[model samples]
Target: MKRNIVILASAITALCSCNDGASDKAPVADSSEVKTAPENNKYTSQPLVTHIYTADPSAHVFNGRIYIYPSHDTATGTPENDNGDHFNMMDYHILSMDSVGGKITDHGVALNIKDIPWAGRQLWAPDAAFANDTYYLYFPVKDKKDVFHIGVATSKTPEGPFTAEKEPIKGSYSIDPCVFKDDNGSFYMYFGGIWGGQLQKWNNNKYDSAGKLHQPDELAVLPRVAKLSADMKSFAEPVKEIKILDSTGHLYKEKNNDQRFFEAAWMHKYNGKYYFSYSTGDTHNIVYAIGDSPYGPFTYKGLLLAPVEGWTNHHSIIEKDGKWYLFYHDVQLSGKTHLRNVKVAPLVYNADGSIQTVHSQK
Candidate 1:
């Protein structure tokens, strides 16, 4: 999927002020820091195995294996004009590793447009969740007109052919579809970005065409949430749109309108508090908020990290072996296009229940 690249400059300026109270401390290198290997041998290790081109990655530890679902973009820059005539084949791909510290292996495509009935071609950001012995994958796809819609698919294994339900979770021009299962055994899907639109619900527990549901006016904006049915195939309630960071927040000033502050929403509960992390000031920087519940009245926490070499940061938080880590994408050598390369970083929280900082991988 194409990101709004114009916001890169504004993101840099906004991120400069986000470090208000951050200490000047540097990241601590791992004691067993492995020496940098030759380019050909990079993929032979844990760190380099993750250095592949995978954007908007969602990770989970299933049966002692770490599975990563990401939007697959062509490594070859041969641009195929997708101007309504062709389908964007960039499907949701899966990569897995035997353990958290093991080398990741590419498992191939899990779901693609061809798998979905009447699904448009282009597939973008995807998020996955496990429920009732099944893996549910939520992702966005574009139709002939290039209009985006969110869809869901299921698979028995984390790395396998995911069966696309006949319908999408909700039909609308939406992207970054993320699924979050609550402690109460409830399911919720969150999505929305540049359009400044809100979230929607699948009240009927079924998928329909984009034109079937209400217009964008009926939906909520950034960081929206909706409750899903027990079966995880349909919605049990109206989509509840939540604005974790509103115009009143420090990052959303009128002056920063060019920045397009709200996008890339990812939520996870830890220590009895709900944390919502999102991209701000372009993909170059990230910010977060805290809420009491999934359908929350979230308050802005502040900027988590600034742009490093103009590389935008889109992140996901997962707890593995009792520790929390932030999985995000960054630019390799700089330049534009923001074709994400997966990276792992350690996330720290403050005593008062706020995010302290998200550091880069060592």
Candidate 2:
């Protein structure tokens, strides 16, 4: 059953600003549901589960076990369009596994759209984080006005019956909220998407439904990032636009949809460098960039994962027991673009630190 959350404006303000002095340690998974698998069988390219559709997997290692927070895809029969109307997801489910190629357990209904007081519909892709000894689930949904906003929920366990805050995070407009906890104990949220994600409409900091993407030569629409407050419930400061540049320090133009940011921002630290990877929506590629800081003026590296068997793809990268794995999704199961299933495979990195691209099995 879902837990009801009562949010008090005063309590939220205090929690968002207070210096709680809690350790920024990562969450330790309960051994009851997670076990260690043998090292011999590690890599896999199979769907995590097929009983139900899921997509945009955001994977993490909590206490050495893999936990996936994914968008629960529902077959609502809504017509597909450039605005993403066909993805009529209304809830989220949490998936877990002891290792790659091992059995996956679906912890059903971590959160539902009906539980969120301010949300109207469409519970799109979500990400999870652990801090202050609490598990946080960050998601994007449309509000009463039909504008997308990022909202947060909290729980004590990694697999959650999470209780959402009464309101959406202030100044958060767009989709795909990936919260990265830095080694320095700071948290950063990277988010935004074009088209149905509603990011292009807010280029001027105000919503204009007819607002279009930049010209072919102009600086393309960039993703947004902001540092989280101590409590991880709200932004500590104003949101800033991330600058993704090319090798020669040139901004990727709007016409370069194959290289420009469309949606799904994920950050993982590798060899002291920050890797920022995102999807090139229409072009059907998963590309990345590298930078010295989390908030990057990053230089484009290259494709991390090539085109998959669907119209959209989103993923997460995690290092477990010295091996890296890429968790992503495709429509292989249902053969419909809006219905996708999550899968995993080994992600290799060159000695030079560049990712060796993995092509999906169509």
Candidate 3:
């Protein structure tokens, strides 16, 4: 297994190495129904770990273990709120477990914000995957200009002290970078956000490729799609604009635009159907659309996971050992939106190939 990794980090000796460990076509037994030791809360199992808050969970199953790469939510600075005062994140920690209800191990901080030459302080939702034996971590952070740029890091192991490339992926600017490696071995990248094209340009402003400033309306930032070259750092083709639904779906449109997909674009292939799932920002429901190809003429499906208590809902769906799990975060512990904790629950599919809406406990 180690033979396929690209060990680029100089501190190979310091990499967080430890024992490590979703989703479904068939009926999966409710994890809450598993009947573990009774607890005061509705959830039967605890948040994978509580050492610190983590959000925007991206789970990947590699070598039969479910590895989670989540943004490290912090309370060190001002509290996080809806007005974007603080969503202070600086690094990512890799968490993994052998199975459900098992010991969740901390693989340590895999990457840090300070290491990236172009990165600003905020390190938001990120993702990890294994392709061609090398594990790649895709992360997003605002540069000095406060523009969100998606970047990549490589490691020989899933849990690592990864070395990041000096520059963000060219022609790529957005948050919540999620990459899906299809069954046929092709790779695709998805990213974007709202508020005048991803975080309101950090100041309700807009800028062109030359960093020239303008009003938000001058730029339109929707979820984006691109094919990744074999190296995983550059685009194989020009990044394309994508829409979750089209005229095929019965929905009203003003000049054919729909904001159903707010952000957190996650993709997975199940039973030959491409399930394009994402979080609807303003409304706060994790919804999905179905597509026949990686690039889609998609048909919209309803909620996979409904709105939770938190203001923001970011999620990832995966199938493990014939069962599906939807990983998301909520402000259950801190009672504050920014200090969110990651949680996982079983995700099921309906007969029509749509995902079931999950009802979670507080």
Q: What TM-score would each prediction reach against the true structure?
A: 0.72, 0.87, 0.80
With candidate 1 superimposed using the best TM-score fit, by how many Å does residue 187's alpha carbon deviate from the native? 1.1
Q: Which lDDT tens digits does candidate 3 get at residues 1-362?
A: 13311121111111211111111112123211222222225432245555567789999888899898998887656654543548767888788877554567777679988898889767888998787788999998888977778899999999888999999998777788889988878899988776523533433224444432223344323467889999988889877766566446543232222335667889998889998888767677787888898888567867677677778888898888898878888765566677776777766676777675665542
Could you say which candidate leads in lDDT? 2
lDDT of 1 by residue, 234-298 (tens): 76776555755554653233234323345678889978888777775344567777788887767
Tens-digit per-residue lDDT, 169-191, candidate 2: 99899999999988999999999
Model 1, stretches more than 4 Å misplaced? 1-52, 75-89, 171-173, 195-221, 245-261, 281-283, 308-311, 333-338, 359-362
> Which candidate number has the best TM-score?
2
Candidate 1 versus truth, CA RMSD in Å, comes to: 10.8
- The TM-score, computed over Cα atoms with residue i paired to residue i, of candidate 3 is 0.80
Clashing residue pairs, backbone N/CA/C < 3 A, model 1 = 197-221, 198-220, 198-221, 199-220, 201-239, 205-234, 205-235, 283-312, 284-312
How well does candidate 2 match the true structure in TM-score terms?
A: 0.87
lDDT of 1 at 57: 70
What lDDT score belongs to each candidate, Candidate 1 first?
0.57, 0.82, 0.70
Q: What is the lDDT of residue 80 in candidate 1?
A: 37
